[model samples]
Target chain A: MRNLFNYIAKYHFFFLFVFLQVISIMLVIQNHHYHRSLFINSSNFLAGNLYDMRNNVVQYFALKSINEQLAQENQALMEKFPESFMKTDQQIFEFRDTLHQKQFRYINAKIINNSVRNRNNYLTINKGSMHGVQPDMGVITTEGVIGIVQNVSRNFSTVMSFLHSETQISAKIKKNNHLGTITWQGYDYQKATMLYIPPHLELARGDTIITSGFSHIFPEGIPIGTIDEFEVKRGDYFFTIEVDLFIDFNQIEYVNIVKNVFRDELTELEQSQ
Target chain B: MEFTALKYFGRFIVIIFIQIMILNHIYFGGYITPYIYPLFILMMPFSIKGWVLLVVAFFSGLTMDMFSNTPGMHSSATVLIAFLRPAVINFISTKKEFETSTEPSFSVMGKTGVFFYVLILIFVHHFSMFLLETFRLDEIGAVFMRSLFSTIASVVVIMLAFLFSGRTKKVRI
Candidate 1:
């Protein structure tokens, strides 16, 4: 026992280093999973509040661009208003439209902290559980798909950005409806890779890619990106395709958190099968 | 002793602030991110205990991880560099004896010494960080390229910081 104590006292520095490193590695492994709830992320209270305060000061400089984006979105929404259309049908038919029901709801959120350079990027937004934000919900901008909410605190949430290597969104080519998966290659912030696309399908530059709505997270037909380049390697079954994302992640200050109303039902039904 | 402790505490806050607020935002092509926070560890007084250095490095890295949302990567890399710091210092020191209380700086080590010291330590930190982050053998080429670019960027920034601080210290004295 005395020798053991002496040995421990002699190599205590090495032991301490090992101990701290072990704990840190464990934290890293634990936080690697998409669904894991991390305790030390920016969504936590202190970091969230710090980001919020910084964003308050920084947001003023971005007001002009934000206004432009909002105006563009407003014009798009205004074009869909009932007043924008002239009724040409003389025969008035009263029928309940049961085909289209409200399946998705949007909650406004301001991004307080964001990053695109990291291999696994995350964005911290001001809205959280207090504002009905939840994990696994999709986040989007007016132009295109953003990411999925990963962790949520009381007043803040962290979104896994589309630039992340682990991001895999079900997408399809809008022209022919050829389905594939969208994933970021951890390189370009403005680009992603469309994988599992069959080589036989005719692909072209500027082909639109949108969410297929196969998952519960996002609604269908949300634009993801456009095909930039594609080629089939010899003996390869899939086309190696590159997509140019529509949204410039660096300039995004605002996002909309998507809440699928029947998400629970859909997930449960899928699980039963 | 208390004054020294307070000074280091202030430096800790300032370095972390610059790292999180300014340096973190400066991303060059998703390849280079200048991490100046490791300068804090490099500047610690030589008299600091080994275990204390490790502990300080661990907490400093954890704080950075909390802000950046990269949980263990920074901590792991910081701790590795902290562990190797003493050996590197001893390897580079020309004289058999030097002041134990003095911290490593441009003035004390000269241009070449400080440059090599920062280069070695920052490269180690960046390589380990990038390795842990990607954790894939297939992407080793990308990882090496990223680490090399980031290390170059970090070394330049850290040297600039050293030059600026050395000038200020001279003025103060």
Candidate 2:
């Protein structure tokens, strides 16, 4: 025991370094998924409260833009007012729209924290489990999709942004329905890479891409981006394409957390397979 | 002795406050965040034990990570730099024996010594942080560019901090 003590005393610094380094690396590995490590993230109580305080001060600066967005939405809603209907249904036809099933419900939230520069970027929203937010719920702005909910605490949550390297969002070309995946190249926030697109399709510079809805996270027909550039991948059948995202993540303030009502049902049905 | 301890504690709080509240917001083209919190680590008294220093570094980095929403990236980098600091100091110092309760600063080490000290530590910290943040073999060039820019920015911030503290301004040769 004395010999062991002597050895440790002799190499105390080295041991300390190794010990700390291991802990740090363990933290990094544990936080890689982030979904299960909610408390370690900024969404935790103390961090979340600090950010909330900061956001309270910062939110005022973005008031003009937020007001504009709200005003625009209000104007759109006002246009759909019952008084605006050309024909007042004297014979009130019992009309429940059969076209939409209300599978996706949205919970409004504000982003308290955001990052776009890193390889794996994430955003923290004020809403969490208490606000009906859960992991795998889709987060979106008025413009387009922002990201998917990664970790959720009681009053806060972290979203793995679409800009992350691991997030290969399933998207398809709007014109011919050419299936492709959208991924960030960790460079330009406005630009992203579109993969699995066949070279056979005649690609245009401004081709629209929307979510395929195959992942059950986002609904179909949600506009993701427009093709900014494209090129044939050498020796491969796929095209190396670049897209300009409709949603600017840096300026995103308000978001809607989408809860798919039938997600569990769908998952259960798939699990049986 | 109590006053000095309280002063250091206050400095720790102030530094952490500025880092989270102000410095974290200064996102230089989204690639660099000027991190000067390591200045606290660098300014520790020479008599501080290895384990204590490591603990301080961990907490300092963990604080930054908490605010920045980056879990372990900063902590790992800071701890690595803290671990390397003793060796670097030993290698650079002309005198083998060190005085007790002496904090590292421009006043203690003079201009050249302090410059090299800050340069090496800041560069290593930034490089490790960027590498860990990216964690991709393909973006080696990106990592280098980011680290370089961030190191330059952080070094400037650290120098400003030193000057602002009246650590170097009054002792100008």
Candidate 3:
């Protein structure tokens, strides 16, 4: 017993180092998965507040660009206003047209902290559970799709950005509707790779890629990116196509949280099958 | 003793602020992010106990992870570098002895000594961090590239920091 104690005392530092490394590695593995909830992320109270404070100061510098984006979006929205359309039909139609039911709702949120340099990037938004934000909700901008909400606090949430290595979105080429999965290669912030695209299909440069509505998270036809370059290796069945993403992650300051009203029903029905 | 502890605490806060707030935002070339946070562990007093050093490194890394949303990647890398710091110092400091409680700096270890010290430690920290972040063998090349670029960037920043501080020390003298 004395020998064992002496041995432990002698090599205690090594043991402590190993112990800390094990704990850290375990944390890394645990947080790597999409479903696991972590308490120490930036969305936590203290970090969230700190980021919020920083954003308050830094947001001023970005006001001009934000205004420009908002003006552009406003112009687009103005074109969709009811007054912009002239009613040419002589037949009066009933106001209650039940053809389209609401499938998604948008909640506006300001991003307080965002990182694109990391292999697994996450963005912290100011809106959280109190604002009806929840895990797995899709986040998007007026320009393009952003990410999925992973963790939520009272007034803050962390979004797994599309730039993340593990993030895969169901997307399709707009022209032919050929479906593929979009994934980041951890190299470029402005680009992603589209996989599962067979080499036999005709592809062109600048072909638009949009979200396929197959996943309950995002609505169909949201702009993802455009095809940049593609090549098929000999004997390989899939085309290695690079996409130029529409969203410039560095300049993103505001995002909209997408709440799918029928998500629970859709998921339950799929699971039952 | 209390004053020294307070000074170290202040430095901890300042270094972390610079790391997450300032340096984290500077994403040079979209791939390289210079991490000078490990300089805190590198600058620890020579006589710091092993267990204390390890504990300090773990917390320092954990703090960075909290802000960056990487829970364990920084901690694991920092702990490994902290564990190897003593051996690295001994390997480099042949025929010379550092006074107890003296922190490693440009004035204390000279320019080349500090440069090599920062280079090796920062490279190890960044390589381990990138490896753990990716957690795959297939992309080892990307991990190595990232580590190499980031280490070079971090070494330059840390050396500049040392030079500026050394100048201030001269002024104090």
RMSD of each: 2.0, 2.8, 2.0
By DockQ, the candidates rank as 3, 1, 2
Find the 10 residues in a row with the least total lDDT in model 3 chain A: A90-99
lDDT of 1 by residue, A145-171 (tens): 889998899999999888887888999
Better of 1 and 2 by TM-score: 1
Docking class of 2: medium
Best by DockQ: 3
Which of the two, 1 or 3, has more DockQ?
3
Worst 10 residues of 2 chain A by lDDT: A89-98
Error of 1 at B93 (Å): 0.6
Per-residue CA lDDT of candidate 2, range B66-112, in tens?
76667788899999989999888887787756787787766677777
Residue A22 error, candidate 3, Å: 0.6
* Model 1 agreement with the true structure over B7-114: per-residue lDDT tens digits: 999999999999988899887765589999999999998889999999999999999999988899999999999999988988888675558888888768878888
Candidate with top lDDT is: 3
Per residue, candidate 3 scores C-alpha lDDT tens digits across A1-273 of: 999999989999999999999999998998888776468788899999999998999999999999998899899999887777787877445685535887889999999998888888889999999999999999998668899999999999999998887888999999999999998998678999999999889999999999998998998899988999999868888998999998999999889999999999999999999
Deviating ranges (above 4 Å) for candidate 3:
A91-100
Candidate 2: residue A77 Cα off by (Å)? 2.4
Candidate 1 vs candidate 3: the lDDT winner is 3
Model 1 alpha-carbon drift over 4 Å, by segment? A91-100
Q: Which 10-residue span in candidate 1 chain B carries the lowest summed lDDT?
A: B90-99
- The CA lDDT at B153 in model 2 is 90
Residue-level lDDT for A74 in candidate 1: 90
